[model samples]
Target chain A: MRDTIARCETTAHAEGLAAGLTQALAAARDGFSPPGRVAALPADRVPPGAAAVRNRLAEREGIGCFVWPGREAERPHHVRPGHETERPHHDGASDDTTTEFAVLLGAVRLGATRRLLEHAVTHLSGRTVGGEPTLRKQLVLGTVADVMTGVEAARHALLTGASVPDAVADTHERLTELDWETTKLLGASGYLADGPARTAHVSRLLADCWVAAPGGTP
Target chain B: MTELDAPLRELRGMCREAARDLRTRALAVDADPADVERHLDSPTLTLIRVASTPKRFRADGSVDDGGYSGSCLARVIAGVELARGDAGLICANTGPSLAGVAVDALGSEAQQEAFYDAIADGRTWTFFGMTEPDRGSDATAMETRLEAAPDPADGMLLTGAKRYVGNASRGRIGVVFARTGRTALSVRGAVVRIPAAGYEATPLDMIGLRGARICAIDLNGVRVPREDVLGAHLPASRRGLWGIGRTFNVMRTQIASMALGVALAARDLVREERPGWSGHERVSARLDAALALLHDAAVQVDHDPDARRPPSVAKLHITDLAVRTTRWAAHALGPGAMLEHPLLEKWCRDVAAFEFMDGTSNIQRLHITHDVATRATAPRPSAGRVTTPTADRVTAPQGAA
Candidate 1:
């Protein structure tokens, strides 16, 4: 789980890692009972008392994410990344199906990109931070990074002709790298470092990513 | 003498005398008839003397040193006089009077004396005609025009309309901004005093602050003398947008102070009338917070009148707080407060006007974001307050102002 989380390149991958870690922590707090132990017991063998105990343990671990020291071994399990991760594939698939997945991925990425640019206009028009102005700016900048990554992954999937699910999965993997770059820039500058220079940067990057995909057509 | 010390001292002495005279008159309203008569007779002239003395004496006074320039002192004196007499209309009439002070600060020495002398002697009420009907936040985008030729008789033909000019209706002089060259972006301002016949002002009936007579001044080929061109001596490349940005800082601070006065007035009234109200505890807490905020803002404003971002933030916070605090006061006071009680409703109205005065909160925030996005680091708190070093502490970014 730690290795998988460490390898996460996109927001979707990071999110999947986070969800898996959450489940593992939950099971560990339930006293490491065998999977079928409770089923083998009498109807009420694993009493509500055990369930409450497990609930408290989970709560404690959740709280630890914020309060635990950096040196603590358990800290990493609870520390959620600021950026979202890409979605993972549920089944193995051949390469030929990947191209079909790219279309769906492209639509979603394009929609997000459009929304982000629209938000920048509203945000820049106003002077205040917390109001409609700040919200718009944040949305625009935040989604630009996310959409750029998704487009890159979609292009790779389209070229490879993987199954729809495999294509999405591959796209998600490519997105993780872009997401890291975006977060780094955001942390360095209080605003999006590149998007402000020009409105077309996001679109151009996405277009290039699509054209570079294995498929002959964008 | 430091550039401003001598003049500041002289101005302080004048203002002290003026304040004392006003206090004396205020206290003697129901006292001895002779005392009241004497107080009434001398108050106007005495206050005017006090206000104008800052300009005349040009010596540093501790209380009012920042605003006391040769002509600014004169306008402050005029404002103090107008304020003391409770003449809202005359006080409102003083917007253009104050604009002359700004002209003195940014304009040339000749321009300064011309506008200042007129304002000081009560010969002219000059409007700083910058804000246009279509261009509220965008002063540089003003559509007004001033075509210049080589003729000394008609130095420049000013043909543009200035809206919401305070003293426009009765102004003897106008410090107007117009597109002097071909470029709409090439806007330049001049101090032009024309015969009343040359320019016409249509009075604008505003909702509140009825005392200030705001008008729309229309200029049709109103000729301006070459000497009247403010900052004309400076190269356009040098003057640039920095002049307007600098002037906005001063204007915003003054406006904030006015709003602060209104807030103080509202808070005082609520405290006096609602000694045992239900939400007195909550109101007290809010008032305490509001006062703290106001004090922080005022200190920053006084320390550095030119720090654009802090004051913009201060103005937005203070005015919004003023409006909210006044509303709370009105609600807590109930029906009695709502009635023709001079304190409650009048203050609410005054503060409301302030909220929209300089630029709306939206406009202020937009400026703040633009500054912040472009700014490498937050500005130091007006170069006065000591900021302790931290790891993430980036040095203050130097802005245009």
Candidate 2:
């Protein structure tokens, strides 16, 4: 688990969020178990590009289930979480979200979140707005620093077991926030439909399905 | 709480009533952006079109609710109500919008008439292009240029590209800011009409607010006549940058109000979908406060046309609040609620549109912080407290040294 997180983070830091998320999505397949929610498993488990992952829900034709390759017998499929096109579960389907899946979702997105932060730093450093490099603005610098602080704290929490019961879910929520703050640095361009912000948005949606409420049962 | 005068209250009520039709068309527009064309005849959209146009240009005559274009307060009242039905659809609707505000500020009698006449068809869309491919919202750094034609009779030629522009592809007539020289004063707005040579627009596939059809435009030597240049009669001081500031101040409040409306819509969706959910009261309370802030900002702008911080602060705070509210609505509806409720998911996407509409939150922060610094640097004369070179203290606690 540590090696996977390390590898994904390293790859993301070296490359970008797309490459990092690609690595993270790959790790999502084998080790995690969703409690009957929209499992955003890659098509045929080939792990498509980050853009493909971001547009996964859009591409789907209202079929909100992913069938794992080897587990077709015991668990035929897992429904997608509270999607706009989601179908109601049968009377017997479970609603309890597993903490293990939330933890894994946190790990998968952690590297990508860091990579997004890196991009923000690089962007803020090179650009100037209103006669100053936005990085020199106290507000912009503060937000970037805050995001970095969150990435470090989340990394630390993942390395050593957290004392909080739902630490992973909390981490996921914080990362989502930090990710948004980082995206803010890109100004209007960041909000583009196909921009890096959508990757974080897709990650948040993925987290929403798997991460249970902080006090909820595992 | 905001205390609205009777006329404003009536305006809000009428807008609220018109919002129902807007809601009906919101989903359809989301499904297919081109669907907006089919609904051009919708009573609500028609009323919006007339309301947005200036008084002299309104071929449809005076609206009973007065009009939304006369004041920032009026725009906020109408904007919030109209946007509650669907902010995305408001962007989808073909009307004067920001361009009208710009013309109202900078255009001469003939220019305004020319501008209004172009969009009188109701079907024709209008666009305002300022953000450049590399410059974003830094209007002063605009690279789009207006250079002298080989023959002066042909006037100047416009060349450069703009990205993230609304109605870029659909607009038949619009305004694009371009620099004729290197200085800030050199930047100018030229009234542009399309189907003209050297103008190309391509719609971008936006993840949300598809109805707005945010697009990229490439202007390769588009023709601009001498009279078509905005602020031609005005001195250089009241030209491009001045109009941009005043226009942005008004648009910011409207954008912020629309964002509040979207948040209200998101919260209401939770109430409708999860009927028994008592967890949304907090959301409702926050929205109420945001409405007040939006109204206050509008009132400030109406009183002081050049006021920047109020509108900037309102936009910066409300845009983030609206986006958060949508997420709150999504979570309140339980897991996969977005799948079960299409409107909620669409609101989630639509709310982000407001942040980039006029000025981004970062730009707003700059205006706000600069205002704060100015206030701090100049201590109030009526205050009684210690003042230092680095800080200003108006009031301190009882035990303060």
Number of the top lDDT candidate: 2
Q: Name the top TM-score candidate.
A: 2
Docking class of 1: incorrect
Q: TM-scores of all models?
A: 0.50, 0.84
lDDT of 1 at B28: 29
lDDT of each: 0.44, 0.73
Model 1 chain A weakest 10-residue run by lDDT: A34-43
Clashes of 2: 15
Q: Per-residue lDDT tens digits of candidate 2, residues A1-218?
A: 67776766776557544455456666654444443233443344433331122233333311122322333333211222334345334211132224433544566678668767777778777887767886898878888878878888988776564334367656876887788778777766666656666666666666655554443311
lDDT of 2 by residue, B1-401 (tens): 56988888888888888888889988788878866788888888888998888777887774554435478888999999988988878888898987888888889999999999989888989988888777787877888999999999999999999988888898988888899987767778888998889999998867678788788999999999989999988777667676678788898998898889899988887777556657788889888988898899888888877777889889999999998898777666554445446677788878887887777787787677764676667748676776544322122112222
Q: Which interface RMSD values do the candidates have, in the order shown?
A: 27.1, 5.3
How far in Å is the alpha carbon of A3 misplaced in model 1? 64
Q: Write the per-residue lDDT of candidate 1 for residues A40-139, one digit (tens) a residue.
A: 1111232333321111111221211111112122211112221324211211122222233233333333333333433444444543343344335554
